[model samples]
Target: MNTAHKYMESTQMPSIVAKSLPKTWMTWAVFFFFCASVFGLAMRYFFIGDFPVLEYKNLLHAHSHIALLGWGYLLVTGILVFTFIQNPIRLNIYRKIFLLTVIANLGMMVTFPVQGYGLFSIAFSTFHLLLSYAFTYHFFKDLKNIKSNTGKTLIMLSLVWMVVSTIGLWAIAPIGSILGRLHPLYYLSVQWFLHFQLNGWFVYALLGLLLSFMEKKGYSVQISTPILIALHLSLFLTFALSVAWSNPSNYLLATNAIGVILQAFAYWIILKSAIKYLNHQTNLSKNWINHLLWIGLISLLAKAAIQAALIIPDVANIAFTIRNYVIGFIHLVMLGAITFGLGALALNQNWLVKNLISKIGWITLAFAFVSSEIILLTQGTLLWAKMGFIPQYHLLIFLASALFPLGLIFLLIAQWQASFQKHQLPKFIHKQKNQFKSKNTETMKSTVLMSLGAAMLLMVSCGGGSSENQGSYTPPSAQKEKVADPKGIGEIKNVDLGDGIDEALAQKGKAILDMKCTACYQYDGKRVVGPGFEGVTNRRRAEWIMNMITNVDVMLDEDPVAQKLFEECLTRMPNQNISLDESRQILEYFRKNDFERTGGSDAAMN
Candidate 1:
């Protein structure tokens, strides 16, 4: 009845179960991710003009670092440690390393945002890097007869790639010292690490784990040697896409393009194989853990498609030029693909509580993640086309995003709340039932701890149902209560005459924009996160501009122009929630800029 990876060796089952319960790392990981989600809320605050004390750039650093090191790093490390290493001494050492990892993350959480990469942050960051090297060593040492199974081999390769990715980071200081930070080499080196870390290491590691899981269950989900080779070849070679924007030589571009295409094909093969092997488990697909895995696979497909698109130099250039596109792509992989896989695996262990509150908690986190993504992509599209905005963007997004952290808090509570009372007697009984252990005190203690997993599985087998099958799946609130176009109080209440420029209003609007909108919008005909505002008054109607500035969320929902922006630009504008007076001033500023561009009479312009 044990739900711990079904294929766990009989000898290792006791230890695995012992380490699985309490799920200390998994619970903490979710908590840290939730903490990171708070930074996501802070981003929305910029649009709502809420929490003015927030420092946008610094918090972004905190968010990214927390999500990457705290969540991604922890999940991967935990899976690797618990899955393969059975030696008590080695397991203890792994826990110590995890402890240090936690400390480093805590240090980074404090230092990175405050100083934006000072001595303390750098030390902690480097601490993580060094620990990674240690992980690589231990992982390699612990992996036994890896070549016997494709899944384990893939994991081994992923660890190697992980170490390889850090080469760039190791070189960064020297590279920056020799050439300025702006030098292509410096940035390229950073990109190298990021590219391989996510695409090469993380992707392979997650997939390998899934493959191993299926195989352990007596399924035939093997990735043939050739396909595995092709996958790795493509993964390592796909680094070209990262540097394609530098207008590399034709030979290099072609090589990179081929690699990208190959990467897609490799994934396609893997998917087909997974489906073939998991065909029997379809009946169990209703499980929430399976749901997470499916979502992860879908996101992975999307990632492959996007990477394939970048094979076209023109497409790559456009993507490179648009910052929003970059952020969207990154998040798609991080949140949608990678985190989803990790979340499912963590939940699969059955070490954490399985109850309604935990179920709702995951749903809340998922809702927040999906909502934020839609808003971000909408904003990016709008910026690309110099068009409309998301309706009530910041406020709605903030509200949705809040649920993510809230869900995590509930999940943490669930972890602690999961009962082990019935689980206690069963540990000794389970051993007698299975006859796997003796009555030694140390052995009994460890087995009892480990049997928590088996005991819960027993409870489950004896009619304690999982939330997965509690009822039919309900749609998210957004879809459940569909709004065709939110028009109430959002209607365009005023329109400018567009007759002449008002210098005072123009100046004030400019000042306000510098303070509030500079993160995305630009004024000098050069795009930052969105299109430049130069000659802005010419392309849009006076009323449209006023509505966009003051009532954009409504406009995006109801207005065709705004929808067009969202579709074409692939980024929508966030609702700034500025006052009517401020919006009117912005309109005056736009009119004056248009006047200057058109060589209108100087009196109003001056």
Candidate 2:
């Protein structure tokens, strides 16, 4: 009996941590990601041909809401809880919070597509917001117990940004009601929420998680004072880029340029530190999770480079004007950086099931992400350069998109398989436990030295002592900045009309209106999807009309009269991808329509 008791004491069998992350929550989050991918695949198919039952706009609402709320919010919160909170009580609270969020997500998933921000969808969205507030409160309450200063600082800052982002969402209702949905203020509010949510909250949280992992891996990870100042300060300043598409003030553009430059500089410091740490890890292996993490890090670096490119006015304009570029960039961050990073961490922790199927799933997902990004960017570039559309673009992208759902399905099945694996202990251990007396002295003596040897091996394997590669790189001083000139980038500020409308231009413009403009507007001042164009040449300046057509999004955001029209129409105008010349031609078509109405004079001269 003594021997058995001593043996058990000497063995010191490891038990599950009291605050082990809830695998079930993570699994459900992945399932939501899979669902979001399916919706995305369906959207891609819509580009190839119309799906009668699927409302493209409503489906878009569903896809974005589910991807952001169902997958992003849930996964990020789970990761933060796993990394920071240790008390079982806090863990329980997080579990309950997770379930509530799940309910909100499911509600949005069902309601968004069915009613498109109707009462139910709004209710669910509001519920989710309230729940997030609760989560923020609880998380901060337990934050003091965290030992890692760098991680704690980042986590806290991320939560602050998360809360600040909601201020934008809350402003939306009032802004929309007062200034209309198409008002610059309304658009600014919406972008404010998104900018902070993606770049501020998500970015910081992931970095914090990374720092925590590095600390755990026995690496001395520290954010230098200069880099830290640049990183957090840049988050606030970089929001100017979100409103840059609206042709914001020169000061705003200058600030954004500075922010992006600072952001790039900060990332350089971080990248160097990460490389040094990685180099020092002699025990690192070619594990799939490690490979995934490397890919994620590469994507993060690429994201920094892309943001830095926005310092060019032309690049900034292209980013907003081209829908393909916008979508591609969002996916690059969401899938390439955020998803890959979190997925790698989950895999490292064995939270994601490890199996042949899961390996194939990761490979498929990686390939699909890369292939789809290439297609989207290539098409966007072609369009930007006034080159014609890519041949079979929609079809090729849809095929690539299909693999996302397939990969997720394989991963989901692997997780289910892990749940059913035999959980019995090794036969030898079981037999010894069964046979040994309660206090077996002999058994204890036999394993005592082995236990000590194992402890020593673990300490050596984990690599003790201060990291030798720490603080090797000095951060570069802030550079004297030159802001990019935003004039005539994507906005048309003036137009010089000739003495009379060109008859041939009117004829060409008539064809374009028939094909594109007619879907939304009528020449007879009858509103369809948008306000009519019957007397638009008289009501607005020729420059205004042309600018509105060529720069619909920016016009809707910045123009007061356009805001009123949007308020009355209760719908924002879509970008028709019309060029400056096409817009000038369309202006002539409006002139011709008004000439007939006025019986002789062209109101375009007004």
Candidate 3:
């Protein structure tokens, strides 16, 4: 089919159906994306300089919440309604649910930055979760009325994963409150939610939506049964990769490796299946929509390759330890793949304007994502290698991030123009349509080049600063003072131990030690990654032990005792960021353990 006929076949809706297609919802989804990008830019700015008024962690919470729910979830639901729900009543119900979701999202936007995960923010989040449940129910009910098998099973499974992912979120509060945020279970809960949402729900939904669109354009989607099973099974198994970060057993790592292999297999088979359909669409080869889809596929492949590399324990450890790697991977999936895929699907369906304006916007956005991801991964690798800073890395990242909002602004304007110019065109433009269109395209091409060139120059100029000039450097005196204490050259000044152990505190401390400390230290009189803790209570002062727990970074940096231990062990103890109270709790636990060995004589007290 020719391009125009293909578009007609894909997007030719009856007048009433077209009007009912929830264009406003799509616009809102794009607006949310723009807002999320602005928030992201604000976050990047903080790395250049401090803004104490806006807490960085709180902004992060808001950014992730809005970007995921406000933009990602909303866009998926809007497209699903457009594709599947033909009945007017069902469509109206979806509209209402969509509006409620928006309200919940707005509430989160207002509350999260102010109070983090306090009562109001949690309430808003809970409300959004309930709204999702409602959406899932209605979506399944409507799915039964549709007879098209193309992408149907995938869509259903995607929704099921969406609901299942919430189980992780619900587990977070209890784990965090009872065992503290540093607990492995708490981190595991958060990772569970993230893994399922990103790898399961979003991945499946986008793939299914793309297949559905293909079928609408008269292409048969012939996904084999094995490929489909592999896809679903891979999603469930790959969640082990998320659990691998907590330094689980070798068995779990092996399981994760298997999952990664299965995922790669599934992706390859699916890609192979889709190629036959894609190869026949010659007219689409040069289209921007096709280009975006290709970018998404390439990103997916890159993500899979990265996952494959993580099967190596050293690489997995580095990935877990480095914040940059984690952030880069998330963006790789969210921005580089899912967002681009969504944009292509939207453009294909004519939900987005197919014109020069959108083309420039998308190209700019693509450039920004690519540039920023490269910077992130490069810096992460440098850090992993202990090669230090990247020379004005934050500034470079900020400059690249600035382009995200700019591109979204162009897209927003394009959408506005589409809405405004619907069913209306000037007579002169109609008479000279080709000429006008070609001239605009040429102008836009020049504009895109200039914009990209300027961005590149800014990044290059900023990145030329010395790495020593950035936040990575710390002065000796300031570093010492950060963890210095008059009592023992560490943070803890005093520890008043009772004759007996604090049973409750000891229990909590034992939990913390199991999760955070035992990875390196052993309770038996045998050496491990760090020294054994069997007789530590008798060997070290209570204040000293507490200080080491709370101030390992500065202790290793400045204290002779810590340096001697480090030299003996030939390993630097990692700073677990244990709090003072937690350190005291750990001291109590040590006393209890030592008492068991010393026959309850409290020999350390002497």
Q: How many clashes does each candidate structure show, in the order listed?
A: 16, 11, 0
The best candidate by lDDT is 3
Of the two candidates 1 and 3, the one with more favorable lDDT, higher being better, is 3
Indicate the TM-score of model 1: 0.68
Q: How much lDDT does each candidate structure score?
A: 0.66, 0.71, 0.72
TM-score of each: 0.68, 0.74, 0.69
Decoy 3 TM-score against native = 0.69
Give, for candidate 3, the lowest lDDT window spanning 10 residues: 464-473
- Candidate 3: the clashing residue pairs are none
lDDT of 1: 0.66
Q: Which stretches of candidate 3 lie over 4 Å from their true place?
A: 1-21, 148-150, 176-182, 283-285, 422-606
Q: List, residue by residue over 370-430, the lDDT tens digit for candidate 2.
A: 9999998887777666564578877999999999999999988887677445446567654
lDDT of 1 by residue, 1-606 (tens): 475545344435455334542376676676678778777667657656634443455577678878888888887778776667667556756765665676677767665555444445566789988888887887788786344687788788888888888899888878645643334566678778888888878888888887877777787576777887888888867777666544345565677778878889999998777766555566444687677667777788888888798777656654655554676688778877777776776677664556788888877767766777777667756654545456775577678778777988888788766532224445644554243323332553564344444434433553332223222222222223454332223445446354556787888776556444655765556443356677666666555676777776556545555554543232445444467788778777777776676654223222
Which candidate, 1 or 2, would have the higher lDDT against the true structure? 2
